[model samples]
Target: MDTDAYTTMRFERRGQILTVFFRDPAEANTSDLAIHEEVGRLFHDLREEREARAIVLTGSGPAFFTGLKDPVGSLLWQREQGLPVIDAGRQVARRIVWDLLDVEIPLVAALNGDATGLGATIALFCDAIFMADTATVADPHVRIGVVAGDGGAAIWPMVMGPALAKRYLLTGDPVTASEAAHLGLVTHVCPVGEVLPAATAFARRLAAGAPLAVRYTKMAVNRLLKDTMAGAIEQGLAHELLTFTSEDMVEALTAARDGRTPAFHGR
Candidate 1:
């Protein structure tokens, strides 16, 4: 597959198995606007690749993928452009997460390290998720004064149950790899160095399976997820965007930038 157009991810094909690595390893695969846009678009390219039967999703360096890169920078850019960037971001999420769910082929996630916010949401969409023993998973949207609209509200309750999903989403707490496995949030957990190998092996097994059967099965099973996403995506995204302009959100962002605790007054 020709992946030269992907600026935020590295794509490699090994026979019928494709592995996509999030870029900027040195920065812990922190995503910015360009990366978010790429996430919204990459699946179209993947769908066109007839040779790829399965996919492995992962990030490099110490983290699987952090939430956002330079929140303050993004806020400033939004201010300068007179646009609600947060709303724009949620729209991208709606497109990308839905596209990921619609992918007919099996997909695996190799969580090399911590995955937060959008990263966690993406990981949860995979057919199977394998994490490094030392890694963690979280959707810290509430921590930044936003709703978990990306795929959190749509997928988490299905995978982890509504109570656990509500707890984590409400508190913005991190789930350790072992904890995730215990809670059935991940397919497998291995040592940090073994994550990629295990994920690749799993992907290859799926690639070697009955291709049409695998594709059709994935399509059938994802119906629930698709319905859930469709039902909640619009309202959740709208509410999340509303939070972006709240006094609490501004205070939270400022506190994050200053490395201090924010005092949210529910303004």
Candidate 2:
């Protein structure tokens, strides 16, 4: 695959197995606006990747993916500049999930470290997730004063069921690798430093499988996810956009910046 167009992510191909790394290790591979846009386009472009039969996605450093880069600051800046933050965010968020679902090849996630918010959602969307024993995952959009609308609301319930999904989503609590494994959230949990190797091995196995069978099977299974997303994504993102302009969101951002607890008054 020609991966020179991507900057936030690096790609390595070994035969038919491709490993894609989140490149900004110093920042824990947090997705900024550029990263978000690039990721969506990357997945969209992968539809034409005839060489790679399976892909392994992992981070370069101590995080699989953290979330957004300075989301609070970015939101504040957009508001101050009178930008149409909601429409812009809605477009990016929708494209990421849709493009990811459209990929025909299997996607395996190697959670090398903590994955929070949108990071957790992306991992959950994968065909299989291999997480480090020391790692944790959580969709904490609610904690940051927004709904878990960016594929989180749709995928979490499907992976862990509604009750268990609500427990995490409602509280924004992190689930340890062991806990996630027990709950059937992650496919495998490896010891520290082994996550990538384990995921790569699995992806190689997938790559060696009957290509048409594997691809078609994945397509069949993903139909359920697509249906759920079709139902929930629009409303979830719309609600999240509304929360961006909420008083509670502003207070949450301000309190986080000030190193204090936010006093939300349900505005």
Candidate 3:
């Protein structure tokens, strides 16, 4: 496969296992507007790689992946520049995640460090998620006055059940690797250095397994996830975007920038 074609993500292949490291050497993996566009198309492109029977998806750097580069700045820039917030926000939260769910191949996520917001959502979508012993996961959309529309609403319930999902989503609290494993949210939790190797071994095993059986088994199980996404994503994204124009969102962003607690008026 031509790894150079993807700028935001680095792709490498070893035998039948295709590893997609989230970003290049210079920058940490961030779910900014740029990476949002890259992820939307990567899975579709990977489907054509006949040699790739299984894929390992991981981030390069200290942090596995965090939320947007600057949620406050991005929204403010859109407003200042007279760009459409709803359209752009929906593209990242709804469309990109929707496309990632359609990838047929088995995906292994090696979480080397913290994963927040959309980063957590991306990890949750993978077939097998192995977190570093110290890694943590959280989706803090509510913290910034936005709905968890980026696959959080769809996938969280399936993995952790509705009650636990609601608690985490409502509070926007961090779930440590131990807590995640305890809650049955991740496949395994290993030392930071062991995460990649363990994930690679799992991917290689899947790659060497029966191709048709493996693919079809994954497809069969993901139907539930697909159905849930189809039902919730559109409405969730629409509501999230609507929140973007609210006084609370403005207050949240301003407070974040200025380093103060926002006193929301519930507008």
Candidate 4:
């Protein structure tokens, strides 16, 4: 694959293992529409890269991923410009989840730091997750007046069951690495600074195994996720986009700008 073609992420290849680092550490790897679109396309490209037997995904800085960059501002801008936020959102959301699942190679997440909102969803979707002890994870879309769409509503429930998933998703609370492991949301929890090494080692081990067996096993297990995503993601993203136009969303953005708690009236 042409790694240079990517701008938001950097890729390094070591034998059959590919390590993908989310760039933009200055922004704590926060993703915008451009980054989201790039990520979706990257996964589709990975699916065709036969040389990469395993993939390790991690961030370049203190944050593994921090969700969207200025999502409220972006939404308001889209509204001001009379852009089709819903239409664009649906396409991006669907492509991200679908292309990620379509990758047959084993993918492992190295949670070097906090993973929130879309970040949490992507980390949890991996075949194995290695989270740093100091890192936290959450799907906190509701905190910003958005639904936990973008695979969060679908993947979180599958990872930790609907009951526990709702507890965090509804409140937009952060989960510690230990708590995440206990909930089966993480496969391993390493001390800070060791997450990537452990995850890479694990990925190498998987790469050494019979490639066909590993890939087929992952495909078989992912069937449940794909099915759940099919049923939930579209509706979740639709509702999320609808919330972008809500009065409550405007209030949320205003509160965030003023550094205060949002007073949501559920409008």
Give the best candidate by TM-score.
Answer: 2
Note the Cα lDDT for every prediction shown.
0.82, 0.85, 0.80, 0.85
Candidate 4 per-residue C-alpha lDDT over 1-267 given as tens digits, one digit per residue, 9 for 90 to 100 = 788888788889999999999875356454467777787688889888889899999998778977466766766665555547556866777787888898999999999999987788889889999999999998878887888878899888887889998999999999999999999999999998789999999999999999999999999988877876677888888888777677887788778888899999989
1-267: candidate 3 lDDT, tens digit per residue: 466767777878898889988763336354456666666667667666677888998888776777456678877665565437557767756656755666777889999988888789889988999999999999888887778877787788888889999999988999999999999889999999999999999999998889999988898877777876677777777777777777787888899999999888888
| Candidate 2 backbone collisions, by pair | none
Error of 2 at 82 (Å): 4.3
Candidate 4 lDDT score relative to the true structure: 0.85
Looking at candidate 3, the ten consecutive residues that score lowest on lDDT are 23-32
> Per-residue error at 209 for model 1, in Å?
0.6
Report each candidate's C-alpha RMSD, comma-separated, in the order given.
2.0, 1.8, 2.2, 1.9
Q: TM-score: which is higher, 2 or 3?
A: 2
Off by over 4 Å in 1: 25-31
Question: Which wins on TM-score, candidate 1 or candidate 2?
Answer: 2
Cα lDDT of candidate 2 equals 0.85
Candidate 1 per-residue lDDT over residues 60-91, each given as its tens digit: 65788774568666754654454456567767
